[model samples]
Target: MNAHQSLSRRRMLGLAALGAAALAGQSTITAAPRAAAAPAAGVSDGTFVPAVVVGTGYGAAVSALRLGEAGVSTLMLEMGRLWNQPGPDGDVFCGMLQPDKRSSWFKTRTEAPLGSFLWLDVANRDIEPYAGVLDRVNFDQMSVYVGRGVGGGSLVNGGMAVTPRRSYFEEVLPQVDADEMYSTYFPRANSGLRVKNIDRGWFEQTEWYTYARVGREQAAKAGVGTTFVPNVYDWDYMRREADGTVPRSALTAEVIYGNNHGKVSLDKSYLAAALGTGNVVIETLHQVKTIRQRSDGTYLLTVEQKDDGGKLLATKEISCRHLFLGAGSLGSTELLLRARETGTLANLNSEIGGGWGPNGNVMTARANHVWNPTGARQSSIPALGIDDWDNPDHPVFAEIAPMPAGLETWVSLYLAITKNPERGTFVYDAAKDRADLRWTREQNAPAVAAAKSLFDRINKANTTMYRYDLFGKRLKAFADDFCYHPLGGCVLGRATDNYGRVTGYKNLYVTDGSLIPGSIGVNPFVTITALAERNVERIIREDVKDSHRD
Candidate 1:
């Protein structure tokens, strides 16, 4: 079977696991045994939980849900605030077209990782201090864009829920059980994330996807095949959006900030279900600073609560029998590196901050001819990708991204995922209290070359050239300074055991994108979720349950 067919079959079988009750938006999941009183608010409360999961991203959400389901009371600590409340402007997130301070964290001026039109510092705007949905973490050469609020990257990403090619999976994670991953955890993650493909019939007819169709046609003309990318957005709602029967999100230029509708983010899926268990508590804006093991084998965490202005409110000491780090790639890596540097976790594996990669992300735009007419009515959720990963020399899977500039710009944008083998390392800087990535822009050359090889073919076939206007100034076309998908840092089998159990420390786990060693050739969240699903099950069965029995 082709990739599309295989994906369909997997989706069908996974949906079968969502029994009638869950399909009807009802829960049959029973609450697990409570470990202690729900997580306390103050330091003096002497609070403790059975397990503490850091961050509110995919891995954290999955671990929290699974641990709660297994009767292991869990507490999740997030550095960013919960983004469920609408501001005075009547929206929880700011749109990408008009980004304000709500687009960034603790900054009076907004810093969008993507530079403005003509690279003229015009995209960002100033606003009052508030906890935004997106954060642009700047390093020496790379700027990583990550979501900061309750849903994490789901709050800002394109909602593309893609599984990496199985063959590539084996090559990247050689020790992982490929059969079990494809047959079990991958489908489970897709089903839980509410992933769905766009209706092909609607895609063919909708004006919103004309840009994508043009992209496919151009790619086909260049002998490059295109595939429909699956996403976590609700397809039925998107269909209604096209028919003018519902309020639009994907059609209304709603990505890279947060989708107000049609997107089934983690907040609506796993995290919501976890809360229903009553054994999971999430403390937003509580950032874990230091971690040290107590004499009794429990872990002690020093957490600082911060307000919207990034001001510290209180520092609390909390203890947990088990600690799971799910604070994405950068956050988790920094926490561990800091602990190691300060001698808190002295014997942490030497590979703690190694094997980091940006998933070979490169963004560029093609200036289509006026006759091509890339549409003004464009969907924000990309539904197509030019699949060129089979190319042995320059493998590239380029997503047909939306310009969504609210007008016909005749620009075909692409975010190409390439296979670059370069890896970087992170080091803790004592002076700044930050973790610095040693990756240089020069290391991104391979990724750019891979992307250019494919796009150059399309450009040649179509008699079009790169859109120098979309990216920053100068003749350079590819945007290589930033990455939306930051993978690795604390890699599997290196920093941790195969099951994500950190070596030298019992009950310490790493369950985020940090576990991915370098590139995965596709979006990392699904893989992170599946891996967490696999590891947490074993941990509960072999570790948690055994300890309780003992």
Candidate 2:
């Protein structure tokens, strides 16, 4: 009963938005109200539960909350710590400029996407292996970025709560009802996630957003239409940070690893709301290894409890009546692929590891003119994007990312989501006990080309060129290798039914980004949350009518 346990008990599992708003000078934003967890009937070690959710991400949070509201007892398993306890720096998370062991997931060094600046290895740092927040899972040709904590990807993403265009959403996921999504679920998801826009008047005058202003002006030079993107970071709190009234997290560069304050991550939003339901509980540092069916239509999961140093503590057997996999595209897909290949869940269809894509992700930077100094002081929170998705030839929504290197680097960074038709596949490797991505470098050619088509025009019109030296000495302008938005591995219609029910398994569900087919032409979390909201609502109403009979 120390500080960490006390915090969890009082705040509802990592203190959700209530504590976050309080830390941000009592900001108006807050998550679901805190309700004491209902006393468990008997859920404990080697015990049974009415429902079990794997991963505490957007989907898992939604599922747990909805199920709890429907009077179901649910348990959530996460591979990382609660992240509520502060470290020696008096912060729960370390900053990007001076990252520590908390920046990486059991890696000896921090792997920043911008590996270097001016051909110098200044971004990444050597660190000790720990069960930290951000994790980079390297496959043969692609490196997938994932968040390793209770809040999942919400802890590490850019906080861009973007809802995809209705046309694009219909094109990617035709099975989903577009009318319900755009009209109902999208707004509901935005409200739950607390998405907000920065004031345009503040944007014009603040030095913090000068980087985005320059990006917008540069895109305008190429006749490209730039739009302001909404984010989960508190705009009012950010204004205070810029004014030096509040603690600096986004302004002083606190992203990629984790944000200390102002960011309304899932631990404070959906997950917090889920915890407030009193029927849900989360167990951290527990990784599910295998999934097998019990004799009486129950699911048996072989889970490992580990310490932050990667020490195996115990292996436990837990059974659940219903199982929801919300461990993102990579984690959720691998579990099913392994179960299928190893003959555990033999009925799983061939689509378990198919229709996987990188969402046409490509990262590139432009060498801005010396006259247009893109501000020495910048906020890590992105607020603008060059929207060229209407172009029929190569649709792209490029987020004008900030190069928060704590100095005026004279660079305009972007992470472009292109409409490339290319997709990848995942193959389970029996020897390594892992699912290996079959995506090769050649597969990324179309993605790079689509991004180049848009950026080339900007370069030509602005009389600038690509920053070849940023990505190391190879002179690769576009970073087509690694991707942040990893969608589709267990695709929606192909891998499961229209409502995300597993094709051959009755009580199995896929509720994360694995449902989308490769590309969505925007930041994916909002779409993921909305789709989860839609799916879980139907599930609680139709599937679990008698779930509480016990």
Candidate 3:
């Protein structure tokens, strides 16, 4: 192999070894330990704990950490793998251009958001079914893209950590106190997540972010202003990547699958701290199938322990005095809906499956003029956004996304978060024993129109046109079918109480994207983390510490 390739190989091997050792040596809480499916015959599984958190995403991690810090013994259940060890290629994750079985969740082929390029299906690849990092849960009209590992969505997202405008936040959740969220919880979430911003001086000169600059310039041509967005990816490490000072992850198109370096996922931040508190334990490859309340006021969960190949190893039952459903929008909503439908948790409110939306997500690409060539070297981490949210007509915050094909495709892609009032809901499908989203393509009309409104202005000024070949053979430009930010389903004020307490149950709580109603006007991770911080702080103060029931 070449010298650079050989060096990268050795570096990845060393990292994998260190990660394995760290996981193995977390008894005193050195690093976050991810226990494999089921232990040996004599070992006692974590079948019961003082508290159980049912996810490892932004909100779940926050809840776990706070509970652990509050001295509550907590067990976190994650369905996906830990994703710390290197694979056959000596890397934790595969890049976008070349994906493997590790790119998707139990699917025979990868389901990349960008399904096609130049009308060719060059984005996806067929592989064996395995528990991969990213999962595109397809419904009738909407497909929700979620991460599926120890750190959950943090493992697969673009790492854009954005807080919504206060006015819009009030509009979405008026019940939430804005002063506290802005002053205390938001900063706390930012600190815990290690959110950082790219240096504008470096951003201006770096070849890696040329696409963002191009996007900004094009948007400015139409009088639409752009704003810098914060992210969890280490900006300094990204600059070093551009300078060839370290092995590349973002520069090599490693997003949507996972990032090996630079990015600070929840496992590296909150989950690690939760483990360090010596009160949190994370069990991977354990999926919660159903949840019910016991007669004595405790909650019981029917968990399925499985291997990476979808082989069911054991059907186990776990119980907790306090239960937190921090699973992503789909997983948590489905579990509660199933429980309610099966008469297990009969007191679960009707709002458990209502108020679902895709954060008004719409993706479109522009064929830039040959002269305005976006650079071939692009960072997968998005750093810029078109800040038109204040526009009273059709508010939108369109992020300048990277088309990191490792070559110039002459395409400026955008994933716009529009303020569409349309929302979807989930219904219990008894035959399949799952919650199905009752959303139609017609509901996305407002999002498409809002996106077209902004892009049309840009296209008019730049004399550019939309790329019709990117989404499919329908000659459509706006991709409204899939969304990266899947919000709602167990909405805060509607499905759960103001503090994430379930409306009908005592010790059950909802703490994820499911708490948000529809749109967040930007990326939802920071808001999710902050809201979780707000909710769990109150929860721990009132419920866990004092044994107060909601």
If scored against the real structure, what TM-score would every candidate get? 0.92, 0.94, 0.93
Clashing pairs in 2: 16-268, 17-268
Number of colliding residue pairs in each model:
0, 2, 0
Whole-model lDDT values for every prediction: 0.83, 0.85, 0.86
1-550 per-residue lDDT for model 1 (tens digits): 8744543443343223223223343212123324554454322325877788999899998998888667677788888866655566777666777876677776677776556666576666887777777878889899999998776998889988889999999999999999999999999898878788888988998898999999999999999999998999998999898889987888888888788788988877787767655567677778898899988999999998888788887888989898999999999999999999999999898999999999999998898998999998899999999999999899999899998878898989999999999999999999999899999999999999999999999999999999776566666689999999999999999999999999889999999999997899987889988999999989888888835323
Q: Can you tell me which runs of candidate 2 are displaced by over 4 Å?
A: 1-44
Model 2 residue 284 lDDT score: 74
Candidates ranked, most accurate by TM-score first = 2, 3, 1
Tell me model 1's lDDT, rounded to 2 decimals.
0.83
lDDT of 3 by residue, 1-550 (tens): 8733543343344334336644663211223323332122211344666788999999999998888667677778888887887787989899999999999999999888888887889999998899999998988878889899888999998999898999999999999999999999999899888889889999998888889999999999999999999999999998888888999999999989999889999877787777655556777788899888889999888888888888988888887888999998998899989999999989888888888899999999999989998989999999999999888888999999999988888899999999989989999999988889999999999999999999999999999999999997678899999999889899998888899999888989999999999888889999999999999999998889934221
How well does candidate 1 score on lDDT at residue 161? 82
